[model samples]
Target chain A: MPPATVPDATHWRDVQLHVVTGKGGTGKSTVAAALALALASTGRSVLLCEVEGRQGIARMFDVDPLPYEERQIAKGLPATPGATAPDGSPRGPAGTVHALHIDAESALLDYLAMYYRLGRAGRALDKFGVIEFATTIAPGVRDVLLTGKVFEAAKPGRRGKGARQYDAVVLDAPPTGRITQFLNVSDELAGLAKVGPIKSQADLMMTLFRSSRTAVHFVTVLEEMPVQETADGIADLRRTGLPVGGVVVNLTRPDELDAEDLAQVIAGTADPAALAGDLAAAGLEGSPDDLGALAEHLLAQGRDHAERRALEDSQRALVAGYDVPTYELPRLAGGVDLGGLYELAAHLRRQGMA
Target chain B: MTVSSTDPGSAAARSATHRRSSHRVGPLAGTEGPAPYLDLDALLDDRGTGIVVCCGSGGVGKTTTAAALAMRAAERGRKVVVLTIDPARRLAQSMGIEELDNTPRPVTGLDTSAGGSLDAMMLDMKSTFDEVVESQASPEKARAILENPFYVALSSSFAGTQEYMAMEKLGQIHRQAEADGTYDLIVVDTPPSRSALDFLDAPERLSSFLDGRFIKLLLAPAKGPARVMSMGFGLITNALTKVLGAQVLTDLQTFVAAFDTVFGGFQQRAQQTYSLLQDSRTAFVVVAAPERDALREAAYFVERLADDRMPLAGLVVNRAHPHPPVELSAEEALAAAQRLERRRDDAGLHDPELTEGLLRLHADHVRITEREAALRARFAATHPEVPTAVVPALASDVHDLDGLRRVGELLAPG
Candidate 1:
């Protein structure tokens, strides 16, 4: 077979936004932060936005909560103090990155205030429990608001004609189970609202979400349920004609042994007496029972290794079933820090996703 | 929180011992013949038992279990209400409700012909928060808090806010049920998020968020010297104000000021609720599937309940796959595969490939059985006293009341 063509990280540079979502605990925020850093490394100004006020990306970047305003959390290139650009822009570095956590309810209120010209009506209605009812009592409204905030951040200048503020935006969205509902909220509201302003806004948001300029990455662990959910989510997204970018399998175990070698080891490691002699030769002292225990331990270790490989294989098969590019991130031994996220981002870049 | 007098481990052990003794009574018990189901009547006889908490990891049918348990209580002539926190609308559909919010709604189709009634409610987190503020604060204060931009933002957008509000809703329901002398039982179906423990911690977290020292310090009026000391802070806050285009900080300040008075009462009530969960009437049914990860989470939950002295009623493993018995040796199975491969040319003697595949499948099933047995053994070692019931995997999704009844039948002892 001929060598396959692999898309490089530069392919992602032209894409205006990336939305990362998966099952809860699947490291969606980490992947979003990493993708932002990776894109920033290529000299693009990136805005990493998180809906739901999770503040998870802040922890990933080792910073406090990124306020609603775009604040520069890191500079991809080295910065020189008081540096100025030829275009009269205050330029300290080539590649700059900003982060923000969207306060969804506030964003929704703002949207309502701006679009409906509610003025004091918004505040009054909010006090009358309408805001709470809209956000919490309704099933999909909050998700719609959250997605609307993210969609706004993605195309910041689209609402009002202005210069595009950020080159790209990375959104850490809700988990996979609710993501389709969140993204399709515009469609949901269109049926409910008909020819209203909200319906038109939902229409525009839906267009942006389904456009080629947007990409949705599903993050998952190399476990059965999450992988199954990922597969289901991908199918659901494809059914809705949404852009399913790729799968990022988080916290995968390292490949220490190949199948053939593992089989050989398992087949050859059955003799307790021989194992005892080998251990004795290796400078370990033990009696027959202790040596027997050691042999059983080795067998158990082999079984665990086999099981992990089987799990990885099943996960890969599930991802392959969706025919999406799959990226495997190794499990970090310790805490997930900013540096580790950047490394993962670099890997994504190398895999053709900035 | 009130701790139960009966030791959970001893209770589990007694149940297991009873099962074993019952098995010795006749072959009927041992052979899975129809027998009298486990009596729930004597198990939950306490009139003071106000709440039943069903907690476990996600995708373990915790909501269904809570609903069914509440239904069982209601069917036994006890007024019961089930509070579910599933974001999905399935709970409302399950309870035959067209809509559900933070407030309790009487569950229809409860077979009132039998003189038993059940009520079901789904927690709407934001509405619950609104109710909390509205009920606790004066009308003007409530309006201020509810209308404040920051309050609206935090109540709706915060990650653990739903869990916090769910607890608040539970407290409200529990109090109302007590006041009305209507509900004899309140079953709470916790959110299935991995951090389901938030249900226990939400009250404290919410109270602290309402009256935390850091928030107080931030909200304090900037004096001449204090302003000088907080120069960088003033710059940041100013930038924040400009970007937000509203007095976000002031809004938060006003809301917190209004919330301050009720903060202690909220914490005390939460503590009391937590204690209520520990009471004997509040049976903790730890639900899980046969999957390793779900089992692991269940084990952790069981351990947490045990350490906290909470009343653990029993264990319910949902969707456990049943494996076929092993009748052939590996060598014999291999021989059969070979024979089947040779007989592929023969006319339809259950195609050799099919036979071989079945044999291989049977072997795999045996392995799965061993793995499940190992898991059960480990659980028994840790929680030997707790009686465990396994519900076999259903052929289809439980979509309606009939499906729920089927599931209930499977869960009930026979």
Candidate 2:
């Protein structure tokens, strides 16, 4: 499959799922929440899920612990005009958007109970600390359960089962480094557990994950390490034949200086005499040391400007190499909050990510 | 390289060299007066230096730095174990291991043509917690703690549990290494969290959580009304009972009751471990990338270490982009690009597009260099006394032992 394009609210409507992963501090949950709100605004019943129980999404939406059940965190805000009801029906002002924090352990227990006809065994295992061992001690099992829970949530169910599930499932997955493993653990475990129900389930999970319906969006800062990790994560996921989606380069500094301007600032070879004249005009007074310090200060400012530009350029270059459509999210001057998430969603919408 | 302590002139010169050198050491230079890079060789020279703790924020290559340093020590025929908490599979892949959990696993491919051995383990957080409870608690107590639903939830769900367990794990590893007399050095990679400073506070946090004042109060017997009136214990106990459902309180009391016997030993050992980290032989390498934020985090970490009197070993800035010196002026490049753009318009000149792209690329490179320089300046200002080093951005992903070796080479003594 071709690399998944970064979805705006519109694209999100077409695609039924979105997965966000990044480094721990890189704001994956925030993006997932925003994407959900954005998609919901476009008249889709969006389900936002956080598998790690970070409660970050709930915090972002100003809600308490989002229970295991999906709750409508926001209706279509004015920003997203087209959200709809559950039945492929038109949404009025009372559109629906839901959020859930997947308790991975609970989900794993539930999955085992439902699928393996091992509910009693699962309960016993949990009592004997086997559940804890499987969830936390085992490397890939948690990832498998988490991914399975998310995948299961994405599909639409029969009418009587529930409000026809979610139109789209947005997963705030594990960090980028472990995301490929998290998403592909079922296959890994399947290899380890051949000729079993788990193996069959893993096969199905892999098939679902590899399908076109699934889209993985990697959130990253425009810095060296996170970007590198994002790239590596993308490459690794691709090797597993998973859909490699777009890169969201978060917290990019604004393009404040152009090349020529940046160069002039850095060279210190710029006509200091002219800059001194400008400073004098601007009513700054100084002795020769003061003037020299002033000039040095100006040069440093110029250098800082150049550095920011370079960082952005490097980030763009790195993202460009992936050949997946990359979206740049500008660094907000203030800390990110609910309003900021909404603003980001709106920006993405404008860029055709629905 | 050795300057005599009595040679005043040489010492002064050496200090000056260190100052100058610190400025040159990536971002950590210049901001702080330069000290030489922490001499691990010297630290371990005594054979008494048992543990080296590498602490810093995330994405700093703390794991790689820890591995490299441990490898360096191990290569010198010192049996070494590098304990890392990085959740990445690459940690095992880097050490050429298929898997590593809470248990210390032998690292393959460390038999450097020099006949030394390296061992590595990824900190399995939950397993470590289980081990702590298993070791410290009586069999019945362990069963109670393990079986309790709240205990299971709190052990995994509580914030800072990982940090507390990490300390416990560190102590375990250190004890094992010390007893074995096989490993000369044990290196630790800390989890990246704001509370990563937890190592400093872990003893108190663990002790308090286990059997501190709150738990002690819970465990106290219900007093008669007259006795309660005398101390006001009843009033406080009533408040706690109300806040935590009676059952919840009972569960906690049961857990703490089981844990009470071991609490003193745990606290004392924790204090000892805390002191152990502060020892001269245990150096703290603050690993960070040269990014503005990471460096800022590093600055805060370094200052915190300094404030706490923790031995600041050195700084390792990893994945630093190497900017090639600018060759062409922006004006000239722009002009060339414009000319190329015209040619492309006229004749679909691929060469012109190439030139234009090259110019833009150069311009981008210049910007990156400036940012890197500023980072270096900021780091220098704040941490001028610390010796620092930069690990250049590697072209390939560090997935295997060879990649780690390359990283080790960069970290090795020049």
Candidate 3:
């Protein structure tokens, strides 16, 4: 096994952009939200953005659907005891999380208006279906515009007034299968627009994507396919010379049985009579047959649990082979509401992911 | 956000547990249920059902479901072909089609006692597109369109290309099946898109982009028949050139002009496939996990299918956490576990640690089952007309043929 480069207090402290990608249904949006909250400190304005126009962040925070504009969605979680400054003082108050549902057409309009000041011409382009073609049908302009918006948010400075400068930007990018091509915009645009503003914009985003200030984290569940995708995704990111970040193992199940009990359950040596006697001794009202049935039920569930635990262990071992700092967020019993989001943020901060 | 108490002793949780246990509402609780069952065997046995399209959100086991259905159907004496858009490496190997070169190869090691056969293939999107181009255009014209920079970009990495190519391949396979009688059943696994319905919409999206007035404007100069419309078209072209660079515009115009001749055929084929999907012979099986987002996507797909007047077969809720077939309430289990803990603390005799752990695990299992049941019930309430088949959560991932067969058994159990 490779020696994993574990994240420390200073590891991601200086990152200006955090890109979170994962297999679908791995709770990638939730992890990105938690990471944004983790990175948001006092006086730090973290921008959480979704480029797929899914309005996932808005739904996650239980707010109205966010427009293309960046709006403050929620306040960050209060700094945990683990989140201390260099001198061991408690971190300041929680910061703010602003979210943007960045759609390609609006971003393209914004880009053209900003770069060429072609207000009427841009509207004409829309009338001609050029905006639709560019954003949806064109090869790579949609990604270019999407990442360009994120780049604008994460860039260091601004020249105009009212331009919001974010301390950190968290993007809920596309799925792992398309993530490398999504982020490596330069290569995506190389064949089509080699000398255009879009090409340069893609190149600029590529620079930030490959820099130390950026980290692309992956969220995955402890399943075979998701882990396999994460492994392949990380390798793809590394091969493209992009900055790879830590892995956040989301929705992890807690072990209910210890090793001996699990082994006995798996081996079918669990004493059902003892279990029934224990149930009867615990003051449960049941007949002998009922007790036997209940004991069998519990043993069946235990065996399933044991098997799942074995699978999860193997998957975790596979994740460990990636040699990156890995953090785990437990599966919330109830669904992830806002409070649960804060709980996950606290877990990330405790793991020094901020 | 209010921090709702997750404590087992909380009044809300206890009451909820009582409600669930009293009603026995779960995937496996067949004694008290009106939840509809999707008869996979009947669907597979039907000779009129020529195509089955499996679609849903990603990570919801759509590919596995499609593969299992094909395997089961083929082993039951039907000639089956499964066109999986993207499958895991082990799953492809299990089907004996490790080479995903976009051809349907026969899967060996099937039971064949029923005189059944299974052929599996993975979609290679680029090759599929190339085949379409080669079939549509003359050799030199196809070479021009294929080697064009814009065509390369559109075919290789365009947003809707995979979905489009999947549709194209489906159409090709269906035509060949009809002509040669090679296979009677084709099970299609849709591409894993942000929206599960992208495959259904991809053919239209691509054809519209190709047939739109914008493409006409770009091809006006190349076709040399737009002398009357040049003034307005030149302004748009100049704007496009200023924005996308002159060389980029020229390449696009050239590609569009070359592709224009072939796109009419493409559009007609896409139309035929769309009609094929809406035909009575095609059945749409919406697959989802018992999670909220996946169910929500399933709901959207169900509504969309209804809107499009497509034949809705049923829903397959995969990886459902079904509680053990016992009348144990979570509240009662927790109370018993707490009583055991207290007795152990007081006397230290009868060390009921294992019993306590079992009770807690059972309580946890009950809670999970209740939550999943609620999610499924919510979906059912919205779309009660749709039949559903809930597959229990397997202890391990399905990789090999045996595992897939286990899933098939669970899917349509007697």
Candidate 4:
């Protein structure tokens, strides 16, 4: 069955901006890329922005290092009559995916130029070191500049010839430990800038965030720590009144045991005699001792599997309790590659996370 | 800033224990010569090694490894202290404490009869920063800087502050060891970041930010003369006003001024800490999971540490899948499983499905075990000079002293 959250379809699709975050190491960048791909796969153009200077998006797309300018990495296909995708997401003709690696220093300069029309002074501002100090070192404004870039991209496109509208803007934001404080721009700038064009910009950003136009999606694994962070991160977003979107649990292992076997193993009551007999019938034909050893090994493995499922269930319950929509991406036995990334995007599309 | 005598030129450490595994060859044969495996127990037990810093990206179990190492060191009789920069409460709970503050707390239930003791503390990055500020600055100035909105924001959750403060805290603990012999060894769990090098670079970044010409330029509006500077400052400030507004600029200037007096001290302290880390007595243990991305990150850590001249102890590959004991090949097992399933009704088998399930699980285990082995071999091939240890994935989440003890034993198993 489709996840309860995605049934409305438009619940996530209608929003123009989707900010993706999670605990560190949850593949947040990969998920953001996949979401952008999935959104654009339906013929809807999307922009993927990464703020951390890691150049992760470049590596993800297997392209040369991405500069500050927006570059088209992938184009989506519109849905075909019966097109089968490698990752299993339904596919057709779609729009393109353009990415921007937002450097805080230049982005701050961009913001300044946008408002004050500073050209030579902009380059001079960078030289004089105010840009680096404020954009890189200054607290609050650094994040504002990063998220501000996303907000600027996600705005309703300008009205004129060559006006390009984005179906969604996906931000590979800071990890959970700092995301809330990073995204809470109004509160941050409100305290610092009581009244100015900067404060007005902050106000505009917060207005967009609190509105339905923005949704923050968290990427996580079923592991306890990342799961806890996922729950906590969502609560932080909610506290700031930023829209909390679906939870994308990454690198999930498929359950090997069904409910019946799991219950038996959890209770530690699986029949050893039966297991040995079955092994013998299958041509092992070993002594009882060897058979018993085999049975014990199988039981231990089954027990571990059962215990993990139980823990995963509790972790899933934690996310489920948050009342946010969630999507699970299966663990790729072979590590993620360009093809695997598309597979994941197809998976996300099938699940309607786009 | 005092430069250590050792800083001139140190080549990449060829200290890796496992030499070329000539027996195996593939795409992963890393370009290298042989090196020694890391002796974690010996490193912990050695009096010469004063500190063990576990550095890695998140979800790699660095905190657990640090705790286990500290526990082993204490049990081995080296009054040890572990400082965890991780925000997770697992360390406190595992040590049987409700909360771990900036100050080290003695852990109970350790086998101290051998004369070793373990003390654990969670690094409250902000509190640690405040403590440093409070100790460094006069009372009035400390208060003003602490309450400043800019300072509050920067100190609390600022990006680089935690790593900088961790370095400071390490220096503090090391100094404590020097003074009254509070603890001889410190095992630090570095903060989780997009890049582990941040731990090595944050203090320098912070120091540079404080001492950089940009701050002087910002102060030019108030500190420098107006005749030559006013025109340029005026244009910049005019532009800054439109972006940051005049009020925000004033708040920033106020924070920098209040924080100015300590710039020299901050720079000196950061340098001192860097020198201390580079000292031979300090050991850097890079931890990673047995995955491609994690291994790539581990390589980055290893290279950066070498460039910085931090004494490299070795690499710890955590949560690796152990090769299964059964001799049955996955194909044979599957074939047997299919037979059992086909004969479920014909044969008097008690639970044919269970046996088939067992066979399938075994196949998966074998496959996963081979994958993990390949990944490890790949890493070994690439950085054969980095001594390495592989730890099997534990049966459960490590949440208590006993669990940590188990990890400690596995880390350097007999």
Candidate 5:
């Protein structure tokens, strides 16, 4: 089966909260940021949030470390020439991208102040390490706070506020290994606080998390461990009844060789003498042995490339088994800069991820 | 051999005496001002080295590294037990272990002719915590603590519990190994934490929390008179009780009071393991991929190890794109490829086209090697004292004993 099966329309147009997760070093944060840009590009302000305190968004956007407050980071690509948004809506002007670095402690303080009107008392609690305890040592409370903040932003309506602040919220969640535990705040707190504000908050978040409005997207490169983790993470999420979104294949390499050349290289049948003749015709400066050795070197590289291609093919086959709408982002020759990020975002938008 | 080979004053003579020694150590040996090369076999052979901790950011092959090192050491005649926190299923199966309980099962198919043995185990975090509680507390108290809602949460699903439990299991294994001489070398693969330093920080964080004033404050109500508590204390408890609800507060208080008897032992064991890591017998090997972020994390780990005064063995930059010796540079290869591409417009179907593709592939290879070299050079410049081993990227993942042996050879050549 092909790696990425394009859908008829955008798969996640109705998804308000996009929880991006993957194995470490799989570039999930980059994909999350790009996804946020894609969603926001249609003239809808989107909030990109990271809960791990990595400040990955700030680094990708080349800005200062983000304060706890959500602030404007970048402007998404303008609407494509004649293209419409995923929902068949008219494309508007370029939208804004705002980022927030969510830490458990700050979220806890915010929760206390907002829920209980304990602003001064919360500061005192911080002094006595109650805030730290609740945020860190308390089971599931840390996750509750982090997810609580995202829930507040993504929930349809606030108590006093009339409309939603952002069109969508993109969360750079934990790595795949712990993503299930991280998001299953309800189960995690079920044993700890059978009846409390924390328990009720977790239940509320889980309802939103399991609802159609939320989607947990798996970001992976075409490699063994990350792909395996993605598969496992998806299954875990499914078992937990969480909303599963599309799969994003990130940092993909370009095809450098065609089928025939790749076949010859993999079979070790590419003629070195012929390659030497071509090199001689192109250059004008080497003996038979020099060109022969160079050809052999290039052939070894070709063989390695062919082998890697085979490996990637197997991995793609594995990803195909996932049975989800998959997207591929090309690997930037130079590392991901702001321009590269925008390029990725444009790819996502063109692929109907928005 | 370990100390003398790495000495800068005699490095020239050592290189002269042992052909390919410098190249085997690091390719950019002389040009890069002679960064220390990590001698893996030497480290494995050293009787003084009791533990080898492989740590770095995730997906950089820490599990494979630890497994390979453990297997190499065991085959080279050191009784070794590898404690892998999380290994891919294929790798675990390759070691002939299907189940991943806490017990270290004997790894089959080892050479073992040199009087060595290998055992492997996966850490079960909850089981390890239960073992600690079972060992430290009586039946009734242990049952109470285990069934308590707070204890259940902390042991089973807490963020830092895995890290803390890994340390606990390591301490347990090391103590047993010392008592019975069951193993001479213990290779540990840390958890895939968000930050690699989380393991180092987890024990302290968890212990400090267990020993913190807030926990003591929670225990205060049961231990002392109610009137002795300050009004401020009353206010905090009232707020906590209000927010947490009365039942959760009571559950937490009960758990803490019961757990207080065992937390002292937990802190002591954590301290012992912390010192064990800092001990001279232990060696910290920081692993990383040749990518920018992984290398940057390696640098941070190296610095953190230094600041903490942990004994750092060296760095293993895994999956490095080191190409064979080629005189042509990337620029020359690219130029040749461009010329071939232009000529291909007029030429036949097969030879020129194939040659152009080959040249472009060569050019990409050269560029990648150069980029990796630059990154390694930067790491070496900042951490010149660190002995490094660069392992080339394999075409496929290692999933068998033979594959692991190949990796071992690549890691430490004969």
Candidate 6:
């Protein structure tokens, strides 16, 4: 139950689609990007998709605003040859990576064209604001369209013969609060359509979602609220029979005090006169009262750290109770530049996540 | 303590001292230049200030800040109601209530020395929407609308429903307060949308969806002027019928017809609430942490508030890491700790790890403080006019009233 323990990553080679979601401000997008990079570096070509239109990918890469089109965003270091799955899917080799910002409106336009083959009628609908209706006013339709794009990208031979296949597709999905509704969108549409092509597509999507090939990972911090949310989110995913993946505990701060120091803080057993003597020896000149203040300050901070570590222990236990692999990323104190993103990817790789 | 406006000095110097003094009063000293002091005490204590909206991206302690503000305002003798959209159950329980619902409930164990009281409610969006419809539409129409499949979906799980309901609930409380003075201050915690503007745009979006031409055309087949239902509409309806089928269309029209009667009331009420948001008495407190994305969102909120001419009280940078009170550089701390480590390893010094750990901890503290100061400086440089108040990171997550009181003290240290 110790925090920042990067457990063995049960390797997601068999999974095709990875949806990363968590509480807001839990670094969901960053975790998704790192997972994508890790998957790609291990020799599996990958696609990174963002559906909420946050432009988070572009910002993380420090690139110009990406248009609503699929394009190459990054390249991974070549992977050495690796094991193959039982299905004869070659496991890991050096791969290429691409990104797509899934625009709901554009997806709707494409969806209508694909299904109805309505060239002029599509334009008429767009003019008459039916496109807007489908994109906006229609409650569950936009989510379906956004999700449909991911399905096409993940499906083999989706772009016709000789089309590039993605070993993994990473979706930086909505936060945990809305994730169940977002992924269960097919069920939502089923309630509406009853028996149409919409229902059939939804059924297909739900099947894909619940299968072993799909996994939704929860990213969270060790704080009480996010940990509580992660536990709740995992339960919801399990309740609906969605494939739940491992937990990515993001932004864990490094330990600043060892066990003895923590014990002293917790037990209130530090000798004041001895601390004053040590301070004088260390060239920190202070009267006995001044030394007392310094010792008190450090002890207070130590006690605070002790409390946080204890709380984090309970949170880690809660996550462990779910019986899934858990990986941790330390709080990057160097301002989270592109280098930090790679550092996180390397951590995931070391943990065998990819 | 209030950053003296009477200081006759160079503008920059006055502002610098102002910034420094505010930081020293609370937790740490910031080297960042003078952004105006937010004066949270003044903002909360003023009788004219009625509404304080806390908004940011998710997980930035917006709820904690709102709850603390409510407590502070109440203790300051202004009756307060804090409406949080979906707080964790434990948090509600910590406030001495099993759960918060649509109705405001009195919170016990307050100081109440100033004859002030605190009321808290969690915004139940679906129930609020139902209440809006029940109050605005006739009973039969309301019942019909509530039961409609489309209406049920929209009211419960739609994208814009929560935001619209937040506005609706705010308007409801404001109206009630203005009439009978149930509370003088209404503190709101907004939805955790990716963009803060969602709270501002949701009502407009719902209005557009209802009043849009497609809806008019859908309803036209059943009830419309012959001229309005031209040959063009007939062609569009023919295509729509093939696409959506007749039953779905009928459901939508029936939902819209019953919904349309109260749709006007919603739009007008939303407009009124939007105006209230823009009023001088309303203050937008954009909350963020010392992080890149959160501050980026905060900047967007600042620009949006300005664009809409909303009165921005200031920015509240929560969870700020404060530097230690004593002056010690990271280099000095690290050097001292290394010497102690050498002594411990070579000469068997007493409690070596503890002493060394203390120094190292101090070093880490200094480094984080420097980094956060730099980040704050960057934010200050971008939007210098926006006043700011900083709250240092607490040791534990805030739960009960005592935790909130500590937060309130830091929010505006007397």
Q: Identify the superior model by DockQ, candidate 3 or candidate 6.
A: 3
Order the candidates by lDDT, highest first — what do you get? Answer: 3, 5, 6, 4, 2, 1
Which numbered prediction scores highest in DockQ against the true structure?
A: 3
Model 4 C-alpha lDDT per residue in residues A1-354, reported as the tens digit of each score: 234444335568578888888887788888999888888887778899999888889888899988877789987646677864445667557789999899888788777777777887777688778887877577788888888888888898644344457778889988887788888887876667788877788888889888888888999887778887887888788877888888998887656567888888779888887888888888875689888888888888888877877877777777777777889897765566787788899888877676
- DockQ-derived CAPRI band for the predicted complex in model 6: acceptable
Q: For residues B1-414, what per-residue lDDT tens digits would candidate 2 score against the true structure?
A: 111122222322233333423323443433333334544455544477677788776666777778777777777777788887763565566575446456667776665565667888887777777777788878987888788655665565454666777778888878876787667778888877643475677677666565434454555663223454334345444433432235544665676676677677778878878887777767788887766556767787888888877788677777654443323333443455565555556442323332344344444434444455456556765666776665665544456666667777666444
Per-residue accuracy of model 5 over A106-187 as CA lDDT, tens digit each: 8888888889998667777888889888888888788888999999988766664343488889999998878889888888
True-structure lDDT of candidate 4: 0.78
Q: For residues B123-174, what per-residue lDDT tens digits would candidate 4 score against the true structure?
A: 8888888888888899999999999988887887567888998999999999
Query: Tens digits of per-residue lDDT for model 6 on A104-162?
Result: 88987777677777677677788888889878777788788888888878887776434
Q: lDDT of each model, Cα atoms only?
A: 0.63, 0.63, 0.84, 0.78, 0.83, 0.80
Write the residue-wise lDDT of candidate 6 on B1-414 in tens digits: 011122223334334335635533331222345466677888998899999999998888998899999998898888999988877667788765455358889988899999889999888888999998998999999999999888888888788789889988999999999999999999999988877779898878988998998888777766747675566676666666656565666787788888888988888998999999999999999999988889889999999999989999899988877656665566666677777766776443457668778777766665666666666667888888888887888878888899899999988876
> Candidate 4: where are CA atoms >4 Å away?
A1-8, A76-92, A158-163, A266-296, B1-36, B94-100, B221-230, B327-350
User: Model 4's chain B TM-score?
Assistant: 0.89
lDDT of 1 at A112: 74
Give the range where candidate 1 chain B is weakest over 10 consecutive residues by summed lDDT.
Answer: B1-10
Candidate 4 TM-score versus the reference: 0.89
Clashes (backbone N, CA, C under 3 Å), per candidate, total 8, 29, 0, 21, 0, 1
**Candidate 2's chain A scores what TM-score?**
0.83
Cα deviation of B41, candidate 5, in Å: 1.0
Question: Against the native chain B, what TM-score does each candidate's chain B reach?
Answer: 0.79, 0.82, 0.90, 0.89, 0.91, 0.88
List candidate 1 segments past 4 Å from native.
A1-174, A177-214, A217-354, B1-49, B87-91, B108-115, B222-246, B325-339, B351-354
Can you tell me which runs of candidate 3 are displaced by over 4 Å?
A: A1-6, A41-43, A80-83, A86-89, A281-283, B1-34, B225-228, B342-351
- State what share of the real interface contacts each candidate retains: 0.00, 0.00, 0.64, 0.55, 0.66, 0.41
Q: List TM-score per model, in order.
A: 0.56, 0.59, 0.94, 0.89, 0.93, 0.91
